[model samples]
Target chain A: MRLISLTAIAAITAFPLFAHADDRIEDALEARHGYMTMLAINMGTLAGMAKGEIEYDEAAASTAGANIEALGNYAVSDLFIEGTANGEVDDSDALPAIWENPDDFVQKFADLGEAAAGAGEAVKGGQANVGPVVQKLGGTCKVCHDDYRKKD
Target chain B: MAEDQARRVRIWDPALRAFHWLLALLVVANWLLGKFGPNIMTLHFWLGYSIVALLAFRLIWGIIGPESARFSSLFHHPRSVTGYLRDMVKREPSHWPGHNPLGALAVIAMLLVLIWQVGTGLIADPEDFVNVGPLANKVGSDIATKADAWHALGADLILIFVLMHIAAILFYRIWKNEDLIRPMLTGWKWVRRR
Candidate 1:
C-alpha cells in the first residue's frame, strides 16, 4: 500500500512538470519578440531626431537614452531564457558558437549591456560627454559581433 | 615573309586607377593614425567619409561607366575563379584586360565590405566620448551596435586581404616576371606583340 501511494504521488508531481514545458516556449517567444519591438522603437525615435521631425531636448533625449539602457536587459533576459528552453528556432541571429563559448559570449554581452546602460545614464544626466558613452557601447558591439555574427 | 609586331594595351582608366591607389594609401594612413594618436581621429573620420563617397561613385560608375568597370563584367563563375587560382599556384597566372578572376573577386569583396564599414561608421556613436558615426542618430542603438561590430571586423578583414593581395602581386612579379602594379599606375600592359 505504501509503494502504491508513493507511485501515485510521483505521478501527481510529474503533472506540473509537463505543464511548465509549454510555458517555456511562450516565455522564449515573448522575450525575443519584446527585444525586437524595443529595437524598432529605439531606431524610430533616433531617426525622427536625425530627420529633424523631433527636436533634441534633455527630456526627449533622456527618454531615448533610458530606452537604450533597457534594450540590453532584453538581450540578457532573452538569451538566458532561449538557452534554457533550447527551442527549435535556429533562425535566431545568434550563432551556435555562442553556446559553445558560453562563458565568453555571456561575459561579452554582460559587459556590453553594462556599457550601454552606462551610456543611457550618461545621456539621462544630460552629460556633455556623449562621446565616451558612445565609445563604450560601440566597443562592446564590435567585440561581440567579431566573434558571433556569421560572415556571409 | 617574316614580320615582327608589338601590341600595346590600355586597361584601367586614369580616374579609377588614381582613386584605387590613393584610397589604399589613405586607408593605411588612417589605420596607422588611429594606432598612433587621437589627433588624427578627425582626419580618419573624414577619410572614411571620403572612402564612402568614392565607393558610392564607383557603384554608380560600375553601372554606367566603361565596360571593364561594370559589376556584370567583374564577377565570374566559381569554376573560372578556381581555374585562375590553379594557374596562379602553377606560376602561370593569366592577365585580363580588366581584373583577373581572383583579383576581381577580391576587389568587389573589399569594396562591399568597406562600404558596410563606412555606412555603419556614419551612425556609430561612441556615446559622445570620442566619436559618433555621422548618421548614427538615424539608427537605433541596437542597429548601431550591430553595425559597429561589422565595421570593426570588416576593417580587420580588409587589412588582412590587402596584405595578401600585395603578397600575391609581388610573388607574380618575382616568379612570373609580371608587372601587375605597373598597369594600375600607367594604365598600360605590354604583353606579346600581335
Candidate 2:
C-alpha cells in the first residue's frame, strides 16, 4: 500500500513537468514560426509595391517595413534553432542544410536583417525612398530561401 | 463460367474518375499559373473553389457510391498496406479490385491536404497586395497572416506529394509495367488473368 501511494505520487509529480516542457516547446515554435513567416511576408509586400504589382499606401508600407526591421531584433535563441538540423518541429522550411552550413545561414540571416533595417529606414524617410531599399531586401530573401529553404 | 467472370470486372465509378482527372488538371494548372505569373491568380481562385466543391461532392459520393468507390471498401489495415508494398516490390499479382491500400492512403491524404489548404486560403491574407482570400476579413489579421503562411506551405507540400506520386506511377509503369496513369485517364484497366 505504501509503495503504491509512492508510485502514484511520483507519477503525479512528473507528469506535469513533461507536459509543461512539451507545451513550452510547441508554444515557442508556433510563436517563432509565425514571426519569421511574417518577416518574409512583410518583405515580399514591400517588394511588390516597389515592383508596382501592389499600389503603395503610406501607412501600410511604413508599418510593413517597420515590422520587417523590428523582426531583426527578435532573439534568435527564442526560436527552435537546434531543430533545423533534426526536423523536430516544422517551424521553418530551413532544411538540414542550414545547420550543415551554419556560417552561410547566419550570414544570410544577418544580411536579411541588415537589408530590412535599411528598408525600414527608407520607408520611414519617404515612400519614394523605399523602392531601392525593397529591392535590396527582396534579393536577400530570395538568396536565403533558394539556398537554405528546402524545396517542396 | 470462370472465363465469363472476366467480363464483369469494373474498378472506378464514372463520377469518381471524372473528379480524379478534373482535380488533377486543375491542380496542375494552378501550380503552373502560380509559377508563370500573377495574372492567372484569378483563374487559380475559381479553380480552387471548384476543387473545394468537387471535394465536397466526393465526400458525399464516397458514402453513397458503388462498392469500389466507397471509402469503407478501399481503406485497409496497415498490415495490408505493408503486404501490398511487398507485393509491389516483388511484382506479384494483386487480388483486391478497388484502390490498393497505398493508393487509398494517397487519395485520402491528397483530399485532406487540399481541404486544409483551401480552408486556410479562405482566411489567408498575403498582405492584401495581389491576393487576399475570400474570407480573410472574418479572421483577425494575426490569424490571417498565420493562415496565409500555412496556405503557402500546404500548397508547396501538395506539389511535393504530387511529384512523388507521379514519380511512383512512372516507376511502376516502367519498372513493373503497371501503366497506372492510363486507367485514371481512361477509367478502364487492361484485362488481367484471374
Top lDDT model: 2
What lDDT would each prediction earn against the true structure? 0.66, 0.72
User: Per-residue alpha-carbon lDDT of model 1 for B91-119, expressed as tens digits?
Assistant: 54355567778888888888877777687
Instruction: Name the docking class for model 1.
Output: incorrect
Expressed as tens digits, the lDDT of each residue in B1-194 for candidate 2 is: 66534332566778988988888888888766655634315677888898888898889888999877888966899998898787787563343366878988988888889899889878876552335577876897878878867887887889988998999787777776676666666666644443
Which segments of model 1 are wrong by more than 4 Å? A1-152, B1-6, B191-194
Model 2 misplaced regions, further than 4 Å = A1-152, B1-8, B92-96, B190-194
The TM-score obtained for chain B of candidate 1 when compared with the true chain B: 0.87
Worst 10 residues of 1 chain B by lDDT: B1-10
TM-score of chain B of 2: 0.87
